[model samples]
Target: MKGRRITMPEPVHENPPEFLRNAAEPVRDHLLGAAPLPAFLHGADQLSLEDRRLLVDQALVLLEQNYVHLPLKTAMHAVNPVQRLRLLRRRMERQTPQTMPREWLFHAEMSEIFHSVRDLHTNYLLPDPFNDKIAFLPFLVESCTEGDRTRFLVTHVASGFSAPGFEPGVEITHWSGIPILDAVDLNAARFAGSNTAARRSRGVQSLTVRPLVIHLPPLEEWVTVSYIDLAGTARELRQSWQIVENLPSFVSADRDTAVSQGLDLDGDETQRAKVLLFAPRVVAQERAAEADESLPDLGAGEIATSMPKVFRARAVTTPSGTFGHIRIFTFNVSSPGTFVAEFVRLIRQLPQGGLIVDVRDNGGGHIHAAEFTLQTLTPRRIAPEPVQFVNTPLNLRICRRFQGGPGLDLGPWVPSMEQAVETGSVYSGAFPISPENGANAIGQQYFGPVVLITNARCYSATDIFAAGFQDHGIGPVLGTDENTGAGGANVWTHDLLSEFLADDPGTPYTPLPKGAGMRVSIRRTLRVGPNSGTPVEDLGVVPDELHRMTRRDLLEGNTDLLDHAGRLLQGLPPHAVTITEAAPADGALHLKLAAENVDRVDVYLDQRPRASVDLTGGQADLMVQGAASAHTAHLEGFEVGRLVASMTRDLS
Candidate 1:
């Protein structure tokens, strides 16, 4: 008699075989009335019972982890067991596909598995497990691939343990078909080499080597001493005779002083100390080569020399063998002293007849730097002006705190313009319009035609420079298209809670996000453009002459902007003209001007005016300047427009 086929239910166990059908039956039943399976699983008619079980188990795990939290009733009639399992497996694989080891795997099982699925498809299911560990694991895996598992073995397993005294039997356990450690001794050996390599890479030779410290006298005092390395000291010394022999006379110590002190009379101790300081640092970096017989010595001299200090300068040589040079003066954005000194230096160096100032790459550091630099360039000092502040809802918190009493209780100390003035803490300073703030060169007269080079890269401080120059009519600008306008005085504070947490307490405190950084402008700067009452808030300084370059021009390394500037300095005709005018027309005043060299000009009027008249030349038209509520005139020059102004704003 033929026996009827029996469909057994899935079995459950602590650890079930890979092909156990019964193991998945319970899970499948649990999920049957719950979540709906994906459409791709419908074709799993060919899947065997065991394969179905595997898929069921995986789906169960995902459900339990909140990865796929479907309602029970919906999941019940979702799909057949085979199709459901297939879909579950596909989804699981997408979310958490196995990651490739950072380097080639060499331990037999890992090696085989790594190579087998090297290009395996990954669906973004599981978070990357080896992201942060990539740097450390590559060396171990690569070493194993090279058949030099000794380092891997020593560093990972053996180094941390002691050797067993007696002979011992070894037995290995397999987890997920991968062998676990068979013996303690073998594991110890693997750890030893790895640790050593890691230490060497970190510039540490051994636990005994402590960081070297050199004590110096106070800032106002100088001290001298002779030192010798003690016997058995691990620290190494480097020789500097080569450097001493090559020292320039001015830098080297005087022979008489050296002789009187009984020091190496011919040597410069400063240079020698520098050489000696680097010796142990070099030795600490040596590592065992792949072929362990010899250690690879990375000698001190192998390192590249320190980079030379750099200063940017522009030079032009005339046909008559005469040369004109311009060196840009740069200062830290916030530092007032540095800016003042540099401005003075520039004033002294600039030729009386013509000069070019470049502030193309200056990222603003300090507001004081801008003020001082501008003051030095201006002929007279302007009175301290109030920088306007727009009070946003966010700023009200700071204001409340400033007005409130100090402490964890934030209030009563809210900063106001009056309070700032009383405390002298406001950023306001005298604008140098007086002779004291101007040039004091003895030889050449101060009057000269100046040209400023600006570009898109010119930022905060640079923007200020351009504005100041234009305000004083210092010089024409070259190559300033639309200047990057990032100014409003961002509120920066080291207080993390005050910044990020004040806005959001839910975010975790992590240094990665700048410890909850919060920045908002506390003041609005009222900048006077060619047109008045125009603020320099969102809009930056626009160049009078705008120059646009093509990729081909850039590739050719053409500094045509600079060249055109040179021509301008030589009294050549301007490439373009930008005219902005405002008058009244009809009963109300109207204004208009024209520029033959302009490609397109945009006229921005604050409001409609009484009388307006068109100028003959096609420049710009507006109502009376101050008469109108506000009028902003923007003029676009032809290619030649690139050379006229550093920045332009619509202020009518």
Candidate 2:
């Protein structure tokens, strides 16, 4: 035979190469079509075979596992060698995927599998693969980007002896040698598999770090600390920033890429702690020197600062003579007036000019923080905007839990509201009644102009705060087109599928998987806009002025943010009105109101309006209280909702 062409059947598996056949077997079974893990995991170490029979056995077992969310419809339509071979052959012809290393290749396949199971955006998928004991500071998720690759900027790095290459403010572009974007995507995708009871039954990575990168930021450098210190530090950071810490995500070096290289496997799987690979841009001394001048002034500053624990405020006098201020508040807040006292103290130090509230790299804490922040800056009375929740089946369940038991409430209207919960509507807004968001600051006041410097890293409460500033014509916004991260709901996390499983217990409990939990969007928040349903989720507060990060800006760290705010203050609108004092008389009250940008103030008793006083002079006294039947004061802005306030006296 001079020349001949020989044909051979392609292998049955398109993913994971032949070397990973053994390692990927359980995963394949759990996700795709395979038998019960216990059935084969027992003898898996010695069950290597090049024949299609092994794949067929695994597929048969998968069919029995009842992976409902998978592509397969029923056991009758079970997987077999013939079907898998055909699928693999078809896949191979369509795309000749890169022959990447075992790590990347396997991870890519797992990522796809995870997305196929559930939605990652709404679910928690971070996996902890490294240290069991660790701390966390909020890394800027919204600002994490370099083209398509996301880089996490360490506002503050977690303490303790971490892996090598650690520092504050160093932008992390990778995690454990894998790019951070890919790692986060993979980690998020895997946990998405735990959407429901059935999927969670087989879902191993949901809320797990193993087999996926759970830790959002890559490890920088190793440092030493005692567990006591670690515990306190972790709690301190978590409490301060309201951040969640992830366990390390790791795989032993032997099981990593060893098979392809024909290396002997290490028997000690748990002994070897993996390491983090830092980005060359941040870590390389030569690279830093090259871009020192261009990027030095960028947002890089004191990562580890003496700013309280999480909130910091200080007056900054840029080179210009104009007086300005910078305030960075990390935690959104737990209550409305939680930070009022601190905020007032911060503002009191600033000279009358634009105040820069730097909410860069801040993760959301509390929902009321936005209004609470604005209230401290403006003494005007503003309307309490209402938020509507989409009464989706899932949301209704969460609301009901929060709604609490109807067991033995004394309130007369409690049962009626409970009945409404029973007769749940599709959209909560459709109903005549919805909860009005309540937040008020009584004494704090700042009448000066404010410039909000935000990055894509700004978050939930930041979104609300930014939008309020613009909506109320408070001042100019710098650093972005709109606010960065949007707030969808007040996130309340529970262990595993507790939100769904506690009452129903959808599936029988197996071993509780490690480092897994759920962050559920319990209540939907609507922002102030033309549309009552306008959500901060995607349409974050678009800035009144764009301080966008340009290519050059990134190189130079956008040092001009505060400088721009200072410039805007040159033409800032002067104070419009003021609430001077309230004097009680008999069963009535007299209020002194000063108006320059004079419009009108709508007075109210117990949130119910009593009078609308149009300003006739620079100063006037208006009688607001009558008989003292109800003790409340309300001021409505000039036809607008801005400059409004609702005040009430404690009868007790």
TM-scores of all candidate predictions against the true structure: 0.33, 0.51
lDDT of 1 at 48: 34
TM-score of 1: 0.33
- Candidate 1 lDDT, tens digit per residue, 247-364? 1111122221111110111012222222222222211222121123342342321211111000122334333221233433233322245445544554555344455566653434
The prediction achieving the highest lDDT against the true structure is 2
Best by TM-score: 2
Q: Model 2: per-residue lDDT, tens digit, 1-652?
A: 0011112122323352222233222122211221121221233222112212222232222222212112321222232422443453344344422432232232233234333323222322332331132222212222333465433443322212132333343444444455544555654444432223212211211111122232222222221211112222311111111111121212222211111111000101101111111111222222233335332212322221222323444455555435546555444323335455556665666665556777754544444445556665655433333443443333344344544444311133233334546776433542111123334445225656677776544444555566666665556777553445444333333333242336665433222233433233333446554445565543455566766443333334444665676677766654545568776777777777775554676666566777777767656677765735555555543524445322234321
Regions of candidate 2 where Cα sits further than 4 Å from its true position: 1-307, 318-326, 332-336, 377-437, 441-444, 468-473, 481-483, 494-511, 520-525, 548-559, 576-592, 599-617, 621-652
Query: Which runs in model 1 stand beyond 4 Å of their true positions?
Result: 1-311, 318-334, 382-386, 392-446, 486-518, 529-531, 550-558, 572-652
lDDT of 2: 0.39
